[model samples]
Target: MTIAARMDRLPVTRRHRVATVAIGLGLFFDLYEIFLAGVLGSVLEKHFHLGKSELALLLASAFLGMFVGAVAFGRIADRLGRRRAFLLSLGTYSLFSLLAAFSTGPVMLVVMRFLAGLGIGAEPPVSDTYLGDLLPPKHRGRYTAWAYTLAFLGVPAAGFLGRWLVPEAPLGFDGWRWMFVLGALGSLIVFALRTRLPESPRWLAAVGREREAEEIVARFERDAGELPEPVENPVVPAESGRLRELFVPPYRRRTAMMAVFHVLQTMGYYGFGTLAPIVLVAKGFPVVQSLLFTALTYLGYPIGSAVSLPLVERVERKFLVLGSAVLMAVFGIAFGLASASWLIVACGFLYTTASNLFSNAFHIYQAEIFPTALRGTATSGTYALSRLASGVLPFVLLPLLNSAGAGVLFTVVAAAMVLVVVDVGLFGPRTTGRVLEAVNSRVGATTDQEAR
Candidate 1:
């Protein structure tokens, strides 16, 4: 039996659940910093006397850090290992986040934020990659989807924490500073616990460590009271991962589709998510009311993720993504048009829920598309565009919102979703219930058959 099959045959158990929670926490903090930035914005502006442009620059700083980190660390992860890269990323972000609270001015704050972003940037793609490696093909979609489910909770966690902490100095330190400090402390604990996460046996096999890979899979099987199917021992072949392969033949189509997916996904995903409160305020809700509404609306993130938990395995990931994107377009307009507070929160909740479902689908899809050899590199390289688009979004989106109104803002978001629907609907392939190696092997078969 193939190592991938061995992994796929194993049952879901307590170990997988524990590891999911650990990885989920890592993803959570990555988002906590992201949503926390919005809460930090008004406070920083008042303190630093930042103009609209400067605040955008500050916001973009972390995203730019993410862009660089994702691409650079992606290659590093592909070369080294997922576990090391995960810890490195978590530590870097945590340490720098703690330092961000100490910044004396805007310049210092931006630099620290940018540094922290390097770690932030590496984590989601890496966590997505790592989780993909650990989970079985049968259970892959929902297991990884559950991680994002937990991760999106970070959005509301930030909202509630920001609401509680951003009003004034805690312990005579800025409330915004306290937010960073708390994120940093929480990350440090997760970093230490991550040592317990088992290395990806799939990655081990791909890198020519089949014995280690088999042993781990065997351990999982033993725990399930079932030994794995027997296979003759042979020295594993090494994977010489080629960057050019991604742009060639079968992979190129997937590469292109994911590129378009990530870029288009980010415009609405982060733009609305991080900017929710601001968007509500722009629509004429009072500041306090906007914060209250944002907190209420954030409840939908976990709700959406939990909804997808069971259905993820039941449905096709491609269609799920398309379905969620369509709902996001519909709900964004509803949110913009609603006048009463309850309607506004209702529409916003729907939008958040759909957007998170969109997030879970693509996050799983992108990682599933490539071989373990190139999974980190391919996913992160494409995912970087989302990071870059997210970084640049505030620059374009904020201006559009300020100049036009929420109507124009959401119209543009809805327009972007149109592209998302077409791209995934036409080009995206189904990946449910297939081993990663087998999935890529079929691609190889296609190319060879075409060549013949």
Candidate 2:
């Protein structure tokens, strides 16, 4: 039995849950910072007296930095190893977030935000890749969703914190600045915790360190107790994870699909998540009311992720992406059309829920599509497109929001979701219940075609 097969056959264990929680804790800060941009939008605007372009610049800075971070750190994770990459990314983000809290002006704040984004950007794909490497195949999707359930809590945490603190100064320091300080402190704590985690056994094996891989898997087996007999899975020697490998055959199609998907999906995901407070303010709600409503709506992120736990493994991943995209489109449009407070909140909540469902599905799908050698690089490289689009989104959507109404903005959002449905539904391969090596072994043919 190969190491991969042994890993696949192991029962869910204490070590697995602990690792999931540790990675999820890091993701919590990543999301808290991601959503903080929307939560603090109006407050920052008022404080800095930002014009629309300047405001857009502030909104886009972190995403732009994330674009670079995702691409760079993903490759770094592939080269240096997942454990080291995790520490580096978190430390970079934490240090810069603290700096962001002390910014003297809009320019300074934007610079700090961008620097922080470099760390934030690498987390999702790396988290997905790491969790994919850690968990057994049977419960892989569920545990991944479980980690995200914890991570998504950060969304509502950001919203609630903004509601509480953004409205006024606290203890003579700006409330918003305090938010950054808290994120930095929390991230630093998680960084310390992550240091204790072992490297991915699968990653170690692929890198030709079989002894280390065996030791880690042996520990997991001992911790798990009474695992089933291991199945036979041949160890396909790992390919050199060259950058251009992503541009070749079976992977090339996947890379293209993900790139297009990421670029468009941001319009539906971050389109509302990162801009909702500002949109509510545009619709005549007071700034505080907007933050309150946005916070309420943000509650769906964790809830929606929880919703995916049962469905992520039961349903086909591609179908989940399709269904969630449709829901996002419908609910997004409804959110714009809603005139009553109850309806607005309802639509917003549903939209956020569906978007998170979409998030979990795709995150799992992307991580599973590649082999271990390229998992980090491929996941991060394609995922970077979303960050690029998100960076560009403010310039496009904010201007449109200012000139047109929320209805038009959401119409554009709906259009993006429609394309997402097309992209994933038509092109995505089925991955449920399969081991990672089996999914991406053939060079020219995809797992979907091979299965067929």
Candidate 3:
């Protein structure tokens, strides 16, 4: 049996749990940073006396940084290895987040946020790919969703912390500043935890370090104590795939599919996930009320992730993405039309839930479709384009919000989600139970023949 087949047949064990938690805990900070823009935007506007354009810039800074980080680290991880790339990404984000806390003015804050984003951007794609490399195919989506369930808790954590800390400086430091400090400190701790975890055995084997890969797999076998019969799979030659490979057939179509999915998905996902408070404030809620409502709405994130766990393995991933996108469009539009407070929260919560389902499905799908050699590069490159859209979103959406009201803002978000549905429905592959290499091999062979 090949090393990859042995890996696929292994049962869930302690290492899996520890690695998932460590990565998930680290993702908590990544998510906190992503959602921080919405929570901090109103406060910063008041504190810094920021104009609309300046507020947009502040909100977009980390996302812009994420764009650069994802693109750079994707290639780096594919070369240097996932462990090194992830550690550097987390460390860089942590250091800059701490710096962001001390900024004396908007310029310093924006710069700090942008710098921190470099780490933030690489995290999700790298982590997802890392998890994909580690987990068995049957359990892959479910466990990945498990990690995200823990990670999405950061939304409410950010929301409530903003509600509590943003309204008052407990020890004389600004509340918003304290948010950055807490996030940085928490991220550093996760970074330390992750250092103890092993690199992806699959990634090691992919890079031709079969000795290291075997050693790690041996450890997992020891830890697991007993294992099932190993299923044999044909090993595709593990040459390091280059960036240009993704632009070729099979991968090229998958890449294009994800590229469009990521770009459009952000507006719907971040529209409700990151910009909820902004929308609420525009709906005439006071800043405090907006934060509280946003926090309440964010409760759905972890819960939704949890709910998607069983469905992730049971349902076709592409269909999950499609279904969730449709729900988001519906709920987001409902949120725009809601006038009552409970109705507003209800709509917001539903939108958030659908957004996370969409998130988990796509995160797993993107990583699953590619060969491991190019996984990081492909995932991050396409994901970076999403970050670019995320950074550009506030600039576009905020202006639309100001002119057309919440109804129009979310209507635009709905329109984006509609496009996402069509893109994924038409082009995305079914990735529920297929072995990763087999999936790619079949895809490549089929596409190569078509090209002939």
Candidate 4:
């Protein structure tokens, strides 16, 4: 199907909100587990007596697994089904997280982390694609933001769990092991809840499973009233799924741009998140005190999301992306340079607020830019690149942190954030409040003409 044609079928109804809540809960746990890894890093270091490089390597291993999981399961989600793929990824991570709790050495831990990354990496794209497809263009940004808000809940929850659990190391295991075990158990519970949720109607229709799609849509309507009218139908027949769609014509440049943006953004965000506690420790705070500060910094995430919920509709998404990127660059540097713990904590809070805004907008922007036919693949493909970059930065930055200190490390991240602001702001087309079909039509036409 042509991009324009594929977009005309987005489901619009109150059910979108219901579906969003259900899927958003799944995302919450997914993110919770991913962020928990940073805290777990400190515990693992002490437990295994890992040097800086070894810790970095373990992080890199996980990202490598995430990269593979994202790209591979993304295609699977698109080809197989979003609902099935969602459960698969969730189950994969939950199982591996339990395995991680039992790891006896660095090698075993790395292996389990890699496996878990596969599941973690596949989630956002699938969830974003599903949520985007469910909501109408008019409400897409707000609904998308709502979905992300749930995911960001995991950030603080991770900190809370770390602060509370990391010190205990209950039942002959360290706190880090308990973190993994808790995550595993939580995921299993989420997986059971997900089984009760229905599949995406739009996805089923796109893949020519019209009967199944109608049944799902009927279920949604039964619960939530009527769906909105489709904006347009470009009238192209569906064909076999193609991986090359993302690289062809107009999509190629946007896809490439998004990939670079993802890489740089992750470098900045994860660079700060993963290293902030260590920076606090180096500045003279005790371990427990540093973890508390880390938790305080995360408190800004939900605040950022709550604030963005109402304002996202009023602003251009590209501008919001640019504005947040600049804030991240500026405050991230300030955070690294502050001598006073209070100042550092305040700056870290602002940094996370801006980071949350950037991520929330970026997730909505990227998923909307793609056609329904390839949304999962494109979003996941870009996310995989981002995860890979994030996975490697800690390893690289750890050495720099040891040699150059926090100022130099954050300075580099600040520079990367600046580049991302330029790339996304200058080149990205505005997507605020536009109909999905209209956006895809423009992108498709531009891509086709460029191909010629």
Per-candidate TM equals 0.94, 0.98, 0.97, 0.92
lDDT of 3 by residue, 335-440 (tens): 9989899999999888888888888988888899888899999999999999999999988988988998889888889999999989987777677887888768
- Tens-digit lDDT track for model 2 on 29-115? 999999999999999999999999999999999999999999999998888788888888999999999999999999999999999
Model 4 lDDT per residue over 1-452, tens place: 33232333444555666677777777888887777767667767777999988888777776788889999888887898888888999999999989998999999999999999899889888888877776766678888899889778888888888899878868778777888888889889888877876776677877888878777655655655444454464433343457787787556777888988988988777777777877887778887788889989988887788778987789988889999999999999999889898998899999999998988888888887777788889889898998898788876888888898889888999999999988986567677877655456654446434433
- Pick by lDDT: which candidate is best? 2
What's model 3's TM-score?
Answer: 0.97
Residue 99 of model 1: what lDDT? Answer: 98
Count clashing residue pairs in model 4.
Answer: 1
Off by over 4 Å in 1: 227-239, 443-452
Query: What ranking emerges by lDDT with the best candidate at the front?
Result: 2, 3, 1, 4
Q: Of 1 and 2, which scores higher on lDDT?
A: 2
| lDDT (10s digit) by residue, model 1, range 201-302 | 888888888998888887788777855564332232344787987887567888998999889988778888867787877778766567778888888888
Where does candidate 3 stray beyond 4 Å? 235-238, 443-452
Top candidate on TM-score is 2
Candidate 4 deviant stretches above 4 angstroms = 1-14, 224-230, 233-240, 442-452
TM-score of 2: 0.98
Evaluate all candidate structures by whole-model CA lDDT and list the values in order.
0.84, 0.91, 0.89, 0.80
